[model samples]
Target chain A: MLEARNLSVRYGSLTILDNVSFAVGDKQWVMIVGPNGAGKSTVVNAVSRGAPYTGQILLDGKDIRKYKSTELARKIGVLAQDTPVGYSFSVEEVVGLGRYAYSGGMLSSKSSGDAEFVERALELTGLKELRRQSILTLSGGEKQRTFLAQVLAQDPELLILDEPTNHLDLVFQKQTFALIKNWIEETGRSVISVVHDLSLAKAYGTHALLMHRGRLVASGEIPDVLTRENLTSVYDMDVHDWMRKMLSQWEDGQSGNLPV
Target chain B: MKKREGFSLVTYLLFTLAVLVTLIFCVCAGSVSVPVKETVSLIWRAILGAELPQSTAKAIILNVRLPRVICVGFVGASLSICGAAMQGLLRNPLADGTTLGVSSGASIGAILAIAFGVSIPGIEGGGTVVMAIVFAFLALMIILSLAYKLDYTLSTNTIILIGVIFTMFAGSIISLLVTFAGDHVKSIMFWTMGSLSGSSYGNAVTIAAAFAVCAAVLLSCARELNAFAISEDNARNIGVNVRRVKLIVLIAVSALIGVSVSIGGTIGFVGLVIPHMTRMITGPNHKKLLPASIFAGAVFLMLADLVSRVILSPLELPIGVVTSFIGSITFVYIFYSSRKGRG
Candidate 1:
């Protein structure tokens, strides 16, 4: 389990992430959702130690700041958005780099126990076919898959993803969440993801944290936190009516062309 | 996998042999050309403590060419490896000691020694060497910290622009020193242009020792460098202690650059061109690229130094002139070819 207490992040004169806190239990897929600039990504940054924040982030009851980087790496992996691959590294090479923590040091390379993990990641992400292909030549969707496979190879206890499917196709988005869902079910792990797609979040998450303008407006079960009233208040819109209109377009027998 | 390792081992042996052959050839073919056969035989006999016939060729090879060649080899290796390591660490293809202004910063200290006739007590080129190192560290830290503050991803143009500005700043300081040197202006100017003419066994040994230690440290961080080649944030998320690795790597690189600049002046382009060539031939895996670049760099510099000495015959051309001439041309080609549209 992981928990954050009174987490706050300030950028000199402005506060990016106001005092906000949440917890994630084992095997729970917790979705943090809100409009743009709601500090969703900031929480992920603070949790990953990418940004400095005041307050305690505990993993297994120990402060995350106290854990060795390698120790924390074995527990948490992040697949961030828009991470560029500069060189012409092959998909396999990029995926294998995920085994760096297991490599035992910054310098050493070990493949003894990593081949299987990398192979599985490749297979799961549908990247096995492109393992030898240069990452530079891959499309955005394929590149996203490459990075996702890399995080999969990391094999962390808690996977943190921030809009990880931004460049992915709809099918890949489903596959990625399903893959993480399967991993959580099998290993009893957890995932904390910040997603803007409400339907995707509602369909996959076990719990939800709703944020607004750097504040946590609501938190609880997916259904309770995403209530029409809370959504309307936070978004300043008729959230249910908008959703109904979008869903109506996909309704069966309306177009008489395909089943929804 | 076993086959691959064996294949790499053979390549390494072949590369080492090439470096050795180049070293001997450089020793043999100088202004006073010593025959290759005689050069090898004499070197072997000398190593075994056997007396050789006293000849002009033997004297030239032993007293003049050998030390300069050795110094060139180590300086070449250090500069090339430092360039490759930095490119990886900073996640920018354009990154190198010369481009990053570390070399220019280092030359300032060397110039200071020449202008003021300053020498630290009991240390050979003590003031120059120590000052070169201090200024190199200061320059590298300034560039890295400022780059970090300005851009999180270390964009190619931004970092290089910063380095360009830093190099200009250091150049102005050197110009100021030269203006006041009075009689030492020629010496300071010549040092900035770079030459291995005054090289001695002491300088070669110091550079070799520093190169060995720093190469070991950089080689140890190959994985971290590989992670860094993607992005700093990605490196951190994957468990690399970005700050720690960056500190260790930059310090080692700075020490190597300081020692090289102090001993051989500020040789340009060998660092920039050699690593780019190495990546093209050997691929981007630092595990292989780092070692390959070191060997390739040593050989390339020895050849360049030879060209510098022989191209003008009796009068010597600055090694820096030779390298920058070739390096700038090659860099333009690489840039237009590989990074044409992507950049």
Candidate 2:
């Protein structure tokens, strides 16, 4: 289980996240949905210990601050929004880097177990064919999957993804979310994702946290929290009728794409 | 795939043969052409323990040509390896040993040693070696400490900036010392121009030892260096203590550069051009790149020294000048080709 207590983050004098509190229990799929500049990334960064915050974050009932960087990496895998490209490492080599925290040091040899895990990760992410290909040659969607493979290789207790579907096509987006869902079901691991697609969040997430201007407007079970009233209030859009229509379609295993 | 690999191997073999032929041609073409027969016989006698008459041929081959050849090889290898390592560490293709101020720092120490008339204890002709190591290590420490104090991230630009500042300081000191040592100006000038004429057996041994140690240390850290080439943050995340690795590499490379410069004077371009050339043939994987740089550097310098001697006959120009000229031309060619390829 992971929990953030009274989390607040400020950049200079500007408060980015104001006293937000949330928690995710084991095997839960929690989705954070907000409009642009809604501090969703900040909350994810704060939980991953990438950004400083005023409140405490606890993982498995222990303060995350007590853990070292590698220790934290071992427990929680974070895939940031922007994956910078510079290195010339092969796809396999980059994926293998996910086991870095467990590798001890540069000169230390990888264990047989670690290698197996890496192979499995490549297999799961469907990167086996592109293992030896240079990462620079990969397409955008393939690159995202490569990073996803790396996160899978980490095998963290909690996976934190910030816009994992960005830069992905519809097929890739569906494949990626389905893969995440399957992973959670198989491993019984928890996940907290910052998403922009309301339909995706409503489709796969078990819990939802809605935010606006860095303030948590609503949080509960997905069906309870994702109401037409809540969506219209936070987004300042006339999405009440559209959401009700989508909700009914969603109940019938259909995703009604609302016009923006 | 097998055919492709075989073709690459064959190409490498042809390249090696060509370099060997060039090396022999270089050795045989110097002023006062010792006949090819005499040169071969002299080398055979030395190797086979045959008693040859004490001729100038023996002296020329053993003392002058051999030392110069060995010095050229050692200095070239040292500079290229340092260049490759620095480029990888800083993740900048343009970072070379000189850009890091190592050559200038060593030059300052060499000049100071000459100016102060300091001699090594017990070991004759060890002054340059000791001074080179000392000044190189000192300058490296200063740069590293300054970077650390400023909480500056290790980047190519930051390192280059520090190197530029140190180069200015070292050059000023060198100028001041040269101004004061009017009588020794010729010696200082010779040292500055960088010649292989005064290389001795002791200097050769010292330089060879330094190169071997540095190469071994760097080879063992090849994987770490590759990891660093990606990104420091990534390197750290991958279980490498990035700061410590950078420090160790800096100290080791500076020492090699220092010792090489002390023995052969401030030779340039070998470090910058050799590694770049090596990378062009081989990919950026440091495992293969490091060894290729070493061999290519040695071959490049040997040919450069030979040309410097044979090009002007008895009025030998500085090997350093020849190397710089050759290096600049090759660099221009590479720059042009890379730009054209990109376009």
Cα lDDT of model 1 by residue, B52-113, tens digit: 88898878887788888999999999999999999998877778989999999889978887
How far off is residue B61 in model 2, in Å?
2.2
C-alpha RMSD in Å of predicted model 2 compared with the true structure: 5.7
User: Model 1, range A1-260, lDDT digits (tens) per residue?
Assistant: 89999999999979888889999998899999999999999999999888999988999999999988988998999999878777888888889878877878754558587888888888877787898898889988888888888988999999999999877776567667777777787788899999987777777789999999999999988989888898999899877566545543322322111110
In terms of docking quality, model 1 is medium
Just chain B of model 2: what TM-score?
Answer: 0.87
Model 1 chain A poorest 10 in a row by lDDT: A251-260
TM-score attained by chain A of model 2 = 0.91
Task: Please list, in the order the candidates appear, how each scores on TM-score for chain B only.
Answer: 0.95, 0.87
Residue B226 in candidate 1, Cα distance off native in Å: 0.5
By lDDT, the best candidate is 1
Q: For model 2, state the Cα shift of residue B132 in Å.
A: 4.4
Q: Deviation in angstroms for B17 in model 2?
A: 9.5
lDDT of 2 by residue, B1-343 (tens): 1012112566568756755555555556688667777777777787799898798878888767766677777788888999899878876665675666778778888888888887888977578777877887788778757765665555545776787798788878888999998787888887666888888878889889999998988876776777677665555544455657887888789889888888888887688788887876776667767878887888888888887887877788898898878777875676576556435
For each candidate in turn, the TM-score is: 0.95, 0.77
DockQ score of the complex predicted as candidate 2: 0.25
